[model samples]
Target: MKKIFFTLLFFGCCFLISAQTEPKVGDELIIEAQDGPTYHHIKFPKLNILVKRGKVANYKSVHGNVVIIDDVITDKDNNTYVVLKKKDGSKFFGYLTKVKANYEKSIASGEMVVKS
Candidate 1:
């Protein structure tokens, strides 16, 4: 009994350690240009907000852009929201979409690619 319990515990620990903890702060990611101009998987900042900030909210414009994980916000529900910025420390055209997304989900759907 002891042997069986210890073996199960060891495997559980391994599984937990190998689990994916993606979108960690400071991670470099690339915006993947899916077949369409709009990114349906993840939300982008509102067009009006972008334009109000003297920017253009062109979905195609962000294609292939390299961004860094600037902030990671996790709500009480365990939903994750990531704030991304350009590699140069400048914000994205839309900026702060405040959308809840997991990097694994986006990456799996080809919305974002892990650069580093």
Candidate 2:
């Protein structure tokens, strides 16, 4: 019985990992409003820079913005990065290249909803 339980747990963990969504270039997504003050790993540039540039770099302000996946980059360390841009043909407030994990987490948390 213990063997069976252990086997099931192992497979379940694998399934959960496999279920994580991966972002691709040119994917159209919309920013969904998140609760609380957390950005869910969606880190923007410094707050000072945002203020200096006359922009509010918070999740609430970014909610409902159309996000275009501009590029997918893999670094020498095998770390993956995603470039995000605005749909209106302009750069989003600041250059935010999300790490693969953070990008996937945002998707999983419904903070970044893929447009149909």
Which predicted model would earn the best TM-score?
Answer: 1
TM-score (C-alpha, index-matched) for candidate 1 = 0.62
The TM-score between candidate 2 and the true structure equals: 0.59
**lDDT (Cα, tens digit) per residue for candidate 1, span 1-116:** 99999999999998886565545888888888878656665677656767688877666767888888778877797767677777765545645533444655677788988785
* Model 2 residue-pair collision total: 0
Off by over 4 Å in 2: 1-20, 74-80, 94-101
Which digits, one per residue and each the tens of the lDDT, describe model 2 over residues 1-116?
A: 99999999999999987665566888888878878665655565656777778877554556798878778766697555567777876545655434232566677787777798
After superposing candidate 1, which stretches have Cα over 4 Å from the reference? 1-18, 46-57, 94-101
The candidate 1 region of ten consecutive residues with least summed lDDT is: 91-100
